[model samples]
Target: MQRQTTIKKDVSYRGIGLHSGREVSMRLLPAPADTGIVFVRTDAGGRQIHARAANVTSTLRATTVEENGVKVFTIEHLMSALHAHRIDNVCVELNAEEPPVADGSSLAYFDLIESAGIEELRSERHEIVIDRVCRIDDEATGRFVMALPYDGFRVSFISLNPHKLIGTQYEDFHIDAQTYRREIAPARTIAYEKEIDQLREMGLGLGGSLENVIVYNDEGWINPLHFADELVRHKILDVIGDLRLAGIIRGHVIAAASGHALNTALAKQIAASLG
Candidate 1:
């Protein structure tokens, strides 16, 4: 049987928050078996918020979790890294309201977790395996996500934009630790040139730069593309992270034109169905 896992030692990362534009430091510490992933707001009297769909308060541009009026924002990337590494229990301590948006991808977080090392626990791991198909759709946005029975975890994603730079794209992957680290973790988040102004006006993406996020112009990417289908691959990364809110999911997920809102909605439904 597979066993639960946590970091071997404490690891830390420092960077700027994507939306807040404030420098923040976060530390990941090992936790006991069955602890799950818990975020502790050190600046807020050590408030503990479990990384679960029920605690999610916002999914506007990024995922945010709240407990007792205390909030933590932009956590999907880090959470995705933990999930990719098969870390079942971890204590994430943050002094600010959000973790740094390092490189705008899970790659940095993955490196930090790797440096800290992973230790398997004595307890066996458990996952919420979908026995039947579960699906969510947003008619207005033409977004949809579905979970189907599978022997293991996998994700299939499709992205479409009216912009010529990023037209229709599709990707599918059977997610495993090695595949996640190599293919999914390095795919950076993307934003369009036209939307940059509006995002800045809304006080979001303040720390975003061409170095971190893939900027697509009318012609093509401002930076060299990591993969031919990097946009869809990044969508898969976000889906992996969002699904972590329901704990480790063992199934195949298919998504079309889905974003944070649809991801969290489907996560809530999946979590509820398991209960």
Candidate 2:
């Protein structure tokens, strides 16, 4: 049987939160088997929020989970890292309302887990295997997310944008720890030049910069690209992180222009189908 696993020791990091723009410190600690991924807000008197689709309250620019009036922001990247590593149980303690946006990608968190090492638990791990095709769509935007039966976790995404620099980009990943670290983890968040001011007016993306966030304009890209099709790869990365809330999914996720809303909705759908 596949055993649940978590970090072997404590590890910590601090950085700027993408939306809140405040410094947030997080500590990853080993948890008892079957604990799943749990987040506790140290600043909010130890209010705990279980990382699950049902707890998600917002999917604006980032994924937000709330419990007992406490909200945690921008969790997808770290969650994706945990999923890639097959970490089934861990206690994440945060000093603020959000986890830091280190490098605006999962690479930093992945490295942190690597440094801490993984420990297998005696408890058996449970997987939500897709037996049939399931789909969710954003009718207005024509974006959709779906899952199909596969032997391993895989994600195929097609990023559709109207901009001249980024029109249509597509990529699929057979997700594994190594593939994630090398391909998806390093792909940073994307921001259009025109959206910065609007995002600021809404009090979002305050910590975003050319360094952590890749900016593009009508003229051209303001920053360098890691891969020619990095945008589509990052979309796949987000899907991995968001769907992870349901547990280790043993299937293939196929998507097009799907963001947080469709991602979490599919997660909830898959969770509900589990017996």
Candidate 3:
């Protein structure tokens, strides 16, 4: 049986929130077995929000979880790192509403967790294994996500954009610690140049920069890409993190042009189907 795991020591970081544009400090602390991942709002009245789909309050541009009037924002990257490391229990303490952007990828979080090391618990890890095909589709938006029974976690993703700079792209990979760190963790979040002003006007992407995000224009990528299909790879990375909201899932996930909304929706469906 797979053992539940948590970090051996505390790991901390400081950075700016992608949308909030506020400086924040966060620390990941090891927790007891079966604790799962929980976010502690240190700035609030110590509100605790379990990192699960049931607590998710918003998926607009980023994932946010709220409990008792306290909300945590843009947590997908950190969540993805914990999931990749197979960390079943952790308490993420933060002094702000969001975690640091940290190059807009999970790479920094992965490194921090690796440095802290993983400790196995006496309890065995449990996962919600998909027994049948489950799907979530947005016909109007042309977005789709589905899960199928599989022995281990895997993700296949496709990104389709009208912009020539970010045309159709596809990638598939099995979810393992090494593979995730090398391939998916470093894939930075992506956005369109044309949408920058719109996003800022909507009070989002204020902390975004070329250093942390892959900006694409009608011409091409504003910043260098780590992989040719890094955009699609990042999409898969987000899916991996979002699905963790359902706890560990032993299944294969396939997504097309899906973002946080659809990703979390699929997670809710899988969680509800669990028996």
Candidate 4:
């Protein structure tokens, strides 16, 4: 049977939070069996928030978690990395409002987990294997996520960016620790000049630079992809992170024209139903 796992030792890192633009320090500490993944804001007197879809208060541009007016933003990338590494229970301690952006992908997250190592727990894992078809949609953008019954989890993604370099990138992958780390973890987030300008107007993406996220103009693929299929692989990486809001998922997910908003919406719907 698939068992729960946790970091064998504590791992730490420091970087700028994608949205907050403030330097933050975070540590991933091993937790007892069945503890589940929990985020504690040490900067706020140790406020603990369970990593579950129900706690997601906002999906505006990025996933945001809230409890009693306390908020954490830009969490999907880190959470996705943890999940991809097959970590089941962890104590994520942060000294700021958000986790570090770290190259805008899960690559660094993967590296940290590799350094810390993984240990199995006594308890068996609970996976949300879909027995019914479910879907969520954004009418204006025609973006949606659909889940179906399957033996193992998988994701198919299609991204549409107006930038000529990133107009339409498609990727499909069966979700697994090996495949995720090898294929998806290196896909950096892509952005357009127009959107960056808009984010600047709203005082967001203040820490974003071409170094962390791939900035594209009308030209195609400005950033060099570590993998030949980095664009689509990143989509799979994103799907993994977004699904974690459900706490854990065990079935296949197929999506098209989906982004953080739609992905989290589907996860919340699934998380609610499973309860």
Residue-level error in angstroms, candidate 2, position 44:
0.6
Candidate structures ordered by lDDT, highest first? 2, 3, 1, 4
Clashing pairs in 1: none
- TM-score quality measure for candidate 3: 0.98
- Candidate 1 yields a Cα-based lDDT of 0.90
Deviation in Å, model 4, residue 182 alpha carbon = 1.5
- Across residues 70-172, which tens digit of lDDT does each residue of candidate 2 receive? 9897999999999999999999999998899988889999999999999988988997899998799888888999999999988989999988888999998
- Cα-based lDDT for every prediction: 0.90, 0.92, 0.91, 0.82
Tens digits of per-residue lDDT for model 1, 208-275: 99878889877777998888888888889998998899889899999998988889888999999883
Q: Is candidate 3 or candidate 4 better by lDDT?
A: 3
lDDT of 4 by residue, 1-275 (tens): 88888999999999998877899999999999878888899999999888887788877778888886577888888888887777889999999989999998888998998899999988998767788987998888788888988887778888776555556878777878888887888888766766887897887898898778876666555677676556666767777887887866767788887877788888888888873
Candidate 1 shows a clash count of: 0
TM-score per candidate? 0.97, 0.98, 0.98, 0.94
* Residue pairs that clash (backbone atoms under 3 angstroms), model 2: none
Choose 1 or 2, whichever is better by lDDT.
Answer: 2
Compute the lDDT of residue 127 as modeled in candidate 4: 66
Q: Which candidate is the best by TM-score?
A: 2
Candidate 3 worst ten-residue window by lDDT:
158-167
RMSD of 1: 1.2
Residue-pair clashes per candidate: 0, 0, 0, 1
